[model samples]
Every structure is written in structure tokens, then in C-alpha cells.
Target: MGIKSFQGPRQKQTVEEIPLRVSDYMTKKLITFYSDQTIEEVISALIKHRISGGPVVNDKYELIGMISEGDCVKHISESRYHNSPMQDMRVKDRMIANVETIDGNMNIFDAANKFLSAKRRRFPIVENGRLVGQISQMDILKATIKLKSQNW
Candidate 1:
């Protein structure tokens, strides 16, 4: 029974497939830090990775906090005028607790917005309440830049 309206046939919705989500964009090889580590160690890790920051996890690989180069440098700046030795200072003394973390399965948009909003450059990707990987701002930029090449 054709009840003909004036409009022609509709086209099928073309969904631009975004294959790679945050997990695909994140750095699966994570180098995590412990809360007990000193600021010296944290700076070393940051330098080695060439990353601005990284996730601080417990022994069980739970995301606890984040350590950034800025955080370490802040102490350095403050201590420069004083006799306070930054070497003995631990990450627990400078690292920001209650940091925001994202799950590996989250979308790239979510991660990017977080980066724009926060004063951090790194984020830890957790799964099932356990640390699975780390996501840097670079990862998001790389993935989003090459969305077509994403294997998803």
C-alpha cells in the first residue's frame, strides 16, 4: 500500500566509523611511579620518558595520583631561595593526589577535553579498577590526526 508523499527515497545513514578509541590511542607500555618515590626519582622518570608527567600507582596497580615535571619544578623553584634540599623530597610530598583518570575504553574526545581543562599533560588509562595503560596528550593528538589509519 503506497501512500505517496512528495519526498523521494531517503539515503542510508553514512556513519563515519571512528575505529580507534582511547585504548587504541593510549600508550600500552606504562611506566608507573609509586607514592613513596622521591621527587628526584619522579623527575628522572619524566625526563627519561620525555613526558610531562605519569601515573602514580600502588603496588596493586591502582591509579592513586599523578606526578608532573611542573610539580617537581615548583618545589625546586621554592627551594632555590632556601637551604631545603629537593633531593630528599618524595613524590608523595609533591605529586597531586585525587587526580583525574580515564578508562582505556573512553573516547578520544573525552581525553582531549580533559587535557584542555586540566593543568596536566598525562592521564592513566585503567580497566576493571586496575591500571592498564597510560595516555599522553601526544597519543591523543597522534590518534586523532590519523583517524583514518586507525586499526580500531
Candidate 2:
């Protein structure tokens, strides 16, 4: 007798295609700070918005740097030591001038790798030399969840 074939014809699996582009997940509406703004203002904004940091831009809305809670904390510590006032500190003085940006069209997986290698919380997306949006670790997690059914 011929060997019994237990398994039937394989059925194709269907997966809904999801766009994994960075732009799709990046935050378009952002609370940005001005270089001339006072640290006190930035601190208040951070607290009110429940955000750790934000991007700094110029009059033309060009991304110049980033100001974070760490920067504000450092300034506060230094001000206490120097007996200086916090109001005197400006965003430009404490912001990170060398900002790293990503392209909007980049794949989400590639962006995740970048976050791991850069040790960054978020990456700003720039287009035509203008600040467009920002993608964070949270965004990557969201994407992973959405793509779980697929290759993941």
C-alpha cells in the first residue's frame, strides 16, 4: 500500500500590508522652542506638555538644535553653584546644536536600528531642509505591534 498522505494541499497565508515608513508614524504636530526663549519658559512648557524635550528652531522655522530636560537640569545645577538666575539661560545656550535628522521616506525597521545605534530617544524628520516631524522609540514599538502578523 502507498504511504498515506496525512497533510493536504498547503493553504496560502494572507497578511494585510501595512506601510512602515517613518513619515507614517512620525509626529507631525510638535511643540518647538525658539533659540531666544528662556530656559524657565522651556521648563514650564516641558512640564505642561509632559514632554522631556523639544526641537529648537529659528525665525525661518529651520531646525537649529534640540533642548531637553537634561539640559535644563544641568543648567539649574550650574546656576545654583554659580549663584546665577535661571531666567538668564536661553535655549540656544543649552540646546544641542549638532542635531541628527532622518529622512521621512526611510523604513521603520531601519529607523529602529538607527535608534539603537545612536542611543537616542527620538529622531527629527527633515524635508527640503525644513523640520517636518519626529519619530520616537514609542513609534517604533507601535509599528512593531502593527506588523506582528507579518514578518514582524
Candidate 3:
């Protein structure tokens, strides 16, 4: 008899597709601060909201700058050495004026790339020159984990 070939079951792998957008993953419940707000108030707000920092907005809700824990640290250190109180320090004095913003329609992959290329932990999502939401590195990580789980 001729040699017999063994037949094995063929398995078809299924691919999972997940299209993620910044708006879908962004934190809609934003805790923003005003430029005129005192550093003491900003610090209290940050602690109350359990956030490292947030965008500084104007009366029209336009993103004017960004205030972060790092900025606060600088002010605190200087105030300690100068024997000055931080209560009078305004958010605008320590806020980063040159703010970089992202659009809500941006893809998660693109947002990941942007995070890799920058030192920012979060980006404010803006639409029509107004603050809409915020996206953080944690958000991107969660989206990636969700995508991986869907494949399993």
C-alpha cells in the first residue's frame, strides 16, 4: 500500500477589530481651573479631584494654559526659601502658556504615538477652540488592554 497521509483539523483564527477614538476614551468629567485662581485653590482642587493637573481656562472656556503638580512644586520650593506664602500665587503665574492640545477625533494609535514623543502625561481635547475633555496615558493603556482582551 502507498504511504498514507495524516489529516489534521484546520483552525481558522478570528481577528478582532476595535476602533478607538480620543473622545470615546477621554475623561468627560473634567476639573478645570481658571487662570486667576490662586495656587492654594488650585492645589486644593487638584487634591479634591485626585488629579495631578488640569487645563487653565478663560471665561469662554478656552484653554489658555496648563497647570500641573510640577509647576506647583517649583512655586512651593521658591516660596519656602523666600519665606512667602503661596496663597497669593495665581495659576497664570506658574501655568504653561504654550499648551499642546489634541482633537477628540484623533485615533488612539496616534495619541499613543504623541505620548511617546512627548513628556506630557495628559492632553486636553479641544473642539471649536473650547475645552471638551482630557485624555491621559492611563486612558491609552486601558484602551490597549481592552483591545488585547478582545482578541482573546
Candidate 4:
């Protein structure tokens, strides 16, 4: 017979439930940089993570801007071939402000719609007014393709 009830004391995990939302599908362990972090550090971070860009967060964990590979390339070009003092440049001085972002609770349709309508390929998922995770065009496309193939 299937044991219907537990005779011993039940155990519970201390972890809380994160509301299943677009945020849930996002990459939780985000690789981010600070405004005061050097350009070298930023470039190294992007290369190390194999990502195109990341959000720049402050001490309060609030998203202030984003730095992409494109931004770095443009920065280098604008410097007139000057050798950047590795110790001088900071993320804030080179980051793209007014970046596009979305909430985690939004669905894939919304994410896709944003990508199509807004012309933005990546999304920083936020929760409680704080940066939580990131989702990119690749992630969305992968999800779409995977789901479509499942029934085929």
C-alpha cells in the first residue's frame, strides 16, 4: 500500500519560492560589473563569461547602465588609438546608459515581442525594483526552438 501519511516529523527547506516568471527563466548567477571597475576588468569579465554584455550595478544593486562588446569597441575607436591606461577607465565612463530592461514575470511572448518591437536583443530581468537575472535573444530563441521540436 502507498504510505498515505508520514509518521515521522516532516522536514522543510528554508528556501523561499521565487514566483515563476520571466525572471525565473533568466540566468540567476549574473556576471556583473561596478561603475568604478576598470575597462580591462570589464572586457575580461565579458570574455570570461562568453557574453556580449552585462548590466552595471551600483553598491545598492540597482542597474545603472550596461556595457556591451560594441560599446567597448566604440570606446577604443573613439580614443583615437590611444593606449588606455588600464587603471584609469571605469565602467561608468564607458557604459551605455538608458538601457532597455524588462520584468521577470513577463512571458516568452512578451520577451519576443520586445525583441521584435523594441529592436533590443537582450533583457535584464528585474524583481522588487532590483536587478535579478538576464535573458538574451539566444535564450528566447532556444526556448522557442526546443518547445517546437518537442512535439515534432
Global lDDT of each model?
Answer: 0.80, 0.92, 0.90, 0.78
Model 1 ranges off by over 4 Å? 1-18, 148-152
User: Per-prediction RMSD in angstroms?
Assistant: 5.7, 3.2, 4.0, 8.8
Candidate 3, residue 150: CA error in Å?
A: 3.6
Which ten contiguous residues of candidate 2 have the minimum total lDDT?
143-152
Consecutive 10-residue window with the lowest summed lDDT within model 3 = 143-152
Model 3, C-alpha of 25: deviation from truth (Å)? 0.4
In model 2, the runs with Cα more than 4 Å from the true position are 1-16
> CA shift at 61, candidate 3, in angstroms?
0.8
lDDT measured at residue 123 in model 2 versus the true structure, 0 to 100: 90
Model 1 lDDT at residue 30: 77
Write model 4 residue lDDT over 1-152, tens digit each, in one string: 78687679878867554333465467888888899888878888888889888989988888888889888777767665786554577888989888888877787767888889988757887667688889888877666764663432
TM-score order, best first, reads 2, 3, 1, 4
Worst 10 residues of 1 by lDDT: 143-152
TM-score of each: 0.78, 0.88, 0.85, 0.76
Per-residue lDDT for 145 in model 2?
A: 91
- lDDT tens string, model 1, 1-152? 98977787889997777745788877877778898998888888888887787888898988888887888889898888787888778888887888777777778887788789985677777778888888888888788778756554
lDDT of 1 at 76: 90
Candidate number of the best TM-score: 2
lDDT (Cα, tens digit) per residue for candidate 3, span 1-152: 89988888878987655668988899988889998899999888888888899999999999999999889989999999999988989998999999998888899989999998987899999888989999999999988887775642
Better of 2 and 4 by TM-score: 2
